[model samples]
Target chain A: MESLFTWNFASEIVLSTFRMATPLLLVALAELYSERAGLVNIGLDGIMSFGALAGFMISYLTGNPFLGILAGALGGVLVNMVYAFCTVTLCAEQTVYGMALNIFAPAISAFIYRVYFGVSSTLAQATLMKTIAIPVLKDIPFIGPLLFNQTPMVYFAYLMVPFTAVFFNRTKAGLSYKSVGEYPKAAETLGINVVRQKYVACIICGLLAGIGGAYLTTCYVNTYSDGIVAGRGFIALSAVIFGHWTGSGVLMACLLFGFCDALQLKLQIISKDTPYQLFQMIPYVCTLAALAIMGAKKAGPKAKGKPYLREER
Target chain B: MKLGGKSENIIIPLIAVILAFLIGGVIIAALGSNPVDAVGYLVQGAFGSKTNIGATLVKVTPLIFTGLCACFAYRCGVFNLGGEGQFIMGAVTAVWVTVSWGLEGPLACAAALLLGAVAGGIWGAIPGILKVFRGLNEMIVSIMLNYVATLFMGWVYTELLRDGSVPQTFPVPDASKLGRLMPGMRATWGLVIAVLIAAGIYYFLFNTSKGFQLRAVGLNATASRYQGFNVKRYMLFSFIVSGAIAGLGGAIELVGTQFRLMSGFALGFGFDGVAIALIAQLNPLATVLVAYFFAVLRTGATTMQVGSGVPTSVIDIIQALVIIFAVAGMAFVRLPGFKQRMLNRQRGKKEE
Candidate 1:
């Protein structure tokens, strides 16, 4: 008597889930890349904020969302340079530098919003990233649009997941990067440019994480706000850890968490009497639970916070 | 090379603080603010009157707890990134205790402080235990728990503690509050508590067997394990203790400053504590000086904003810059043959 699959609501949930997962995928993959090289990106969250603001600002100024995305990525790299400076050069606590940068990003952006942008809601009519129809794929009925006919950036991000895995697993430098993470001392003895490799991974993280923030602002929300990044960098960090530093693993974790996030939002509309706050917290709570119950697989970097040094050179 | 240890560590931070402010002065000038007037305003705003000094002291109150929170785990070779969560839970637990029964003066204060630490310790231990038992990462655990604690705190405020008359919790009974220490300022006995906690942590960490175990673990976990020390147990203990210190910090803030539980009462102190701890290089005594300097910058920043056309956010920028400069070259003393390894890595990359 029951219809096999309701066309009305369930599909909408799936679509929203995919949409939500996109940014997380981009950012987590970014983390996977950088962390694999033994350098950590704590300011991924801050980079997201800076990207959102930069993307929104650029889109607003030029009336082009594509340009906005580029601007956003560049902005992220710019902010991350500060992180790279303290973490890589100064040999500071990566997490401490990261947390400070996170706090600093919002404060600076909020001030700029007040000072430069003033109190206007939404860069009102700033360009927004829209789905592009794949000519052949667009005509392939329902599943086509959901899968193929999506924003260019989303497709790019999805492609990046596997692309990154191949890069790390196949490329010569990628092997060196992994070696840098596992045994910096041995890798150094073998004459690998450990610090340079570390910088490369970190800078790439900056760019990809910037795109992730750009996706949130230009694609998902179409504007920026104070809590714009909203712990997504941390979420990306969680996804990377949950997936145990693998490319495909991070994608799966991102989708699962993002699905939970979308599902929690839908749960509130299921009935009137349910305590929505409890449901709202399910995604994060799930992240906490998953982090705890995921077992030995989620162990982190070997020489995580320690700076690589050579003989008293 | 043979300079006294304490003097150099302490003096380096002082110089860094001075240098950071000097840079901040340039930033103020760039923002079109007069440096002298801005400095004057900041000094007056943060410590000018009795009321201002009192507020500065109150603000400095929680920093001491967070300082201990960061320093404790850091000393043990495990970084406790969950200070914010611990602080929040401590404040929340304090509120619940105040509501349930009426305990006055020293007992109420003592109870609140202990419960605060316990709550923080437990919160902190979650990550530490995960790190030790399941082989799960502590950084991820601590990071996620922070959001959980914050949201949970927000929920408790909205659901259970909300006075219904306002968006925040109802005030604690007069007896639950630590009495004010000054006539003109809101500073209370909380400052004294903060001081005592810092001093106690310093004495315990630098002078005791427990401190040596933690330092040994931090210096080399494998070596400590070789020495038959339970690295995991101490990591858990110190992390929990650190969380407790931070938790007690949140309770003090509630009792001394806010007098009621509010969402985000602990604010950015937990994160700021990391900066303080780093600047102090995990030295317990150095934490006091760093906390005070940060407190002055924060308290005076508002005045800087008002007096100069510059935004107070320049303080945050300066804070970041300070961390960059502070941790510089700490790796200078690492390993017996660090340079040879560094050069090899560089050469390997070049050949590839």
Candidate 2:
């Protein structure tokens, strides 16, 4: 046990934690925005799956990872428009429609992928995004290597943390978004276009989730596999609740989830005797525990999961 | 002319199915296949022969159980997304009892199924207890439990209950296996049992006072609480009972069809059940019909793929579209203008 907790091993785990957490952080942030605007988008996993395929295909074709990321985000927005239409414009059940997309998008994505690239023994690879190191910052003692040296996507995810904090707390648009979620009728009466805000929130959520999905294919790994997105999208959903819908809280929650993910992978490698499936269960178990402990008291927006209609008395 | 509530409930989903099929045809055409030929193959595959019908019915059996599971829970306003987890736990427990314990005879089948339901109920109660007592979100907790259950199942098969040479549990005893409706057919009496359960659920939801209170809780929890209904208890009851249904389905699938527990056992059935329940408007009888419809699509998908060279995933796309269109159309029908227009039409007809 003492040998297992060596400095090198601990540092490796921490570094991997950041890498693992990047997608979760991005998707959780995306979910935070949608939920804040009273739109519960459970289709994050589906969007991510589509994004992964789009990102992989585009990067494979264009030989440009950034273009693939862009395509992924745009593809996400395109798919999310269906959700926006059903939930925002039509005022349908948010969870049901979101789940519909969750079922729909993945099938379409797989269909497209199979059409473009026939089944083969060898996995089609994409150009992975290269890690970028800040020059002087990398030379700094402990924190430098821990934080400064990482992929551009990882840096961007962390950068959004503060941006989101300020956007929700300080900005006028953010407050309006919050108002729409809290009380759509009141927000509408106050001259805010509640429908438009909800649409925008869905778009933002889709785009970020797409990027998170793309990161798995184009940045984290160089190839795409079926079910690559797995349940990270759902974990991100949990992170939103576990974080109490705050930006920093979500970051902390995502990091903890990422740690569990990384630890599980490491433990799988370290212990050959124990079934790998037991280790694989760690992240989900932790998420459940965290939600049970932290998600009980604080509730989300008042108008969440309800269809807001302007004409209804 | 104004349509009755019962007819409207049926018509909207019917229209959605037609619309989805039309769109699916267009997609198949774009994929360079003859849409007409694909449809022919789909029909032929699902109902081609006695064997094909039996296979389709076998698929429908579990779907009916899972669909009814979702329908029951949703009727109580509880989203028990843990149906898949409950199903897996049920299968695991049944396999353990049937094979590991070496249970024998007809009693073994009955005992295995009951134990499976109990296991599923316990697995489902976790999220319910948390939601009622601790105010945790049931949906997320239930979904998380799915992953845990799946991993646990994996561990059981690969580590604990693994049989000779393969990573799967031992097959159930021959005597414990469910009897078929017809000789040499794969379809078991499970289909009959599932249909009966659906009828039982329909009666419970529409007939009993307790069921009425459950629906009241689902419709408006606060109002139900005001009316002296224990809303929390209803929600928890829905979760447990719903879970038991799914678990029973899992056991039925195990003994009735899949005698050996393996990887990918009962994957996607839970979500499929959710979609079926929603598409059926949460009506138990309608759930059985919708489950059958989904099974038809699934059973036909392989044939369509083989004949037309289109991927079987096109069926999945079609299924998703049906859910989307049905949900969106139902919402549209519920709009004030539409409802008001129907009322006005009926009133004008009476005056004439």
Candidate 3:
């Protein structure tokens, strides 16, 4: 326990904590956008599975991680297109459609994997994304080694933080997006295309979530498996709620969850007396606690999961 | 020439099923297999022989209970996604009782079942109480608790109740075992109990005053409260009942089919129940038929995989597509094209 107080151990834990939180950060932000636009993308789980499989398969076949990332984003766009058709166009219940997509995507990915690679070779490893350290940024003493020297996806995720915050708060398109979520009828009256805005927002949500899923496959585990997402996508959903559906809040929530998860791994190593499963359960338990405490107090988009039919009063 | 009526409820689902199957066939074709042959194998495998049919019935048994669980809560306007967790908790609780107490008879089995229900009910009630008092989203709460229940059950099994030399618990006693309905098939008397439970849920939801209150709350909570119903209490009551039903599903599966509790037992039956409930439109009576349909798909999925060399995950794809179409098609039929068709049909009828 005394050895754990060393700077090296602390840095490693902090580094891993941020690294682990990257996927959650991405997905939570994605969910935030959709939820803010009044569409509940409950199928983020499915999107992740689709993205992971597509991303991994592309990278494996072509040996290029960039292509994998693009494929992941495209896969997400395709899935969310179906979601948009159902929820936005058909005016179906958002949650139910999302749930269906969630169930469907995994099967689609799994079946494709089976057909292409055969059922027995599912565990075949793929080319992983390479980590690139920023040259000058890496020279800074304490902070440089901790934050600057990490994977490209990590930097991209952090860069997205302010960009999303600005887009949500500063831009005309952002206000229109919020208006559609809060009051679609009023937004339509104001000449904002409510359906179009929702479609766009949800598609973007899918893109970010898909990239997050690719992050899981390419950066973290580097191999696709059944249940590889391992409830991270769900955790990301919870992070959106826990963060109170803001970019900064989402960042904090992801960090908190990542810290819990990283700490669990550390504790399991340091202490053998405790059962490892208990440690493994920290993030989920923390989510429940957070939700229970915060509960439904924070009001999200007023028309969040409701389908907007233009003809309906 | 009616556009919207009671028949639309039935018709929409039928259309959804047809559309989903068409899409599923397309997927099969994409996989380089003959869609007709794949489907033929699926149907034949599901009900090819009496034994196969019996196995399908066995698959349908737990689904019936879980479907009722989802339908019951949904009717009262609550989403109980924790059915997976509650189901597992119930199974483990029953397994723990039978193993720890060394009980051997039908009476002991009855006790274990009751214990299972109680444990599952408690597991479910946590989220119910939270939703009522704290005003949390029950769906999210249920999702989180599922992980907790899964991990907790695994811990209990490995640490306390594990059978010697194996990952599973000790075998349940013969006296406690449910009697097989068919000589050569795995179908147990649990099927009858499942049917009875479905009937009971139907009666309770449609025939009783409380049922009416529950349904009223589901339709409009504010109106139900204005009409002197305790909406909060009913919400709580709805989840407890839902949990008990799901827990009973776990208990039944344990004694009747598995006879021992292992890790990963009763995989995703609760989630399937949600799908079943959606397909049935939250009608308890309809859940029986829907559960049977799903059971056929699931039971025959293995045969479809073996004979056609296609993965059984295709069944999941079909199930998901069915749900998507069921929700989407119901709304899509109200669009301009369908409305125009309805008008044309009405004009034709007038001419006739």
Top TM-score hit: 2
- Which run of 10 residues does model 3 chain A get worst, by summed lDDT? A291-300
**Alpha-carbon lDDT, every model:** 0.78, 0.90, 0.86
Instruction: Give a tens-digit lDDT track for model 3, residues B34-99.
Output: 889988889988999998898899899989988888899989999888888888888888888777
Q: Fnat of the models, one by one?
A: 0.48, 0.77, 0.69
lDDT of 3 by residue, A150-240 (tens): 8899999988889888988999988888989899999999999898899889888989999998888888877888677767878888888
> Model 1, range B150-250, lDDT digits (tens) per residue?
77777777777788866588777787787888677787888887888788888887799988888999899999999999998998888888888888888
Tell me the TM-score of each prediction against the true structure.
0.90, 0.98, 0.96
Ranking by DockQ: 2, 3, 1
Q: Which stretches of candidate 1 lie over 4 Å from their true place?
A: A1-6, A89-93, A118-125, A139-142, A183-192, A298-306, B1-8, B100-109, B329-352
Candidate with maximal DockQ: 2
Q: Which of the two candidates, 1 or 2, achieves a greater lDDT against the reference?
A: 2
Docking class of 2: medium
User: What are the per-residue Cα lDDT tens digits for candidate 1 across A1-313?
Assistant: 1332478566667777888899999889878877887777777888888888888888888888899899889887787777776676556667767766776666666656655655544455576777887789768777776677678888898899888888788998778888888888888888997888788777888888888888877888776777778678888888988888888889899999888888877777765475566776787778878877877673556876666755433
Question: Who is ahead in DockQ, 1 or 2?
Answer: 2
Q: Which stretches of candidate 3 lie over 4 Å from their true place?
A: A2-4, B1-4, B334-352
TM-score evaluated only on chain B, model 2? 0.97
**Which digits, one per residue and each the tens of the lDDT, describe model 2 over residues B7-116?**
77888899999999999999999989999999999998999999889889999999998899889999999888888999988888888888877679788998889999
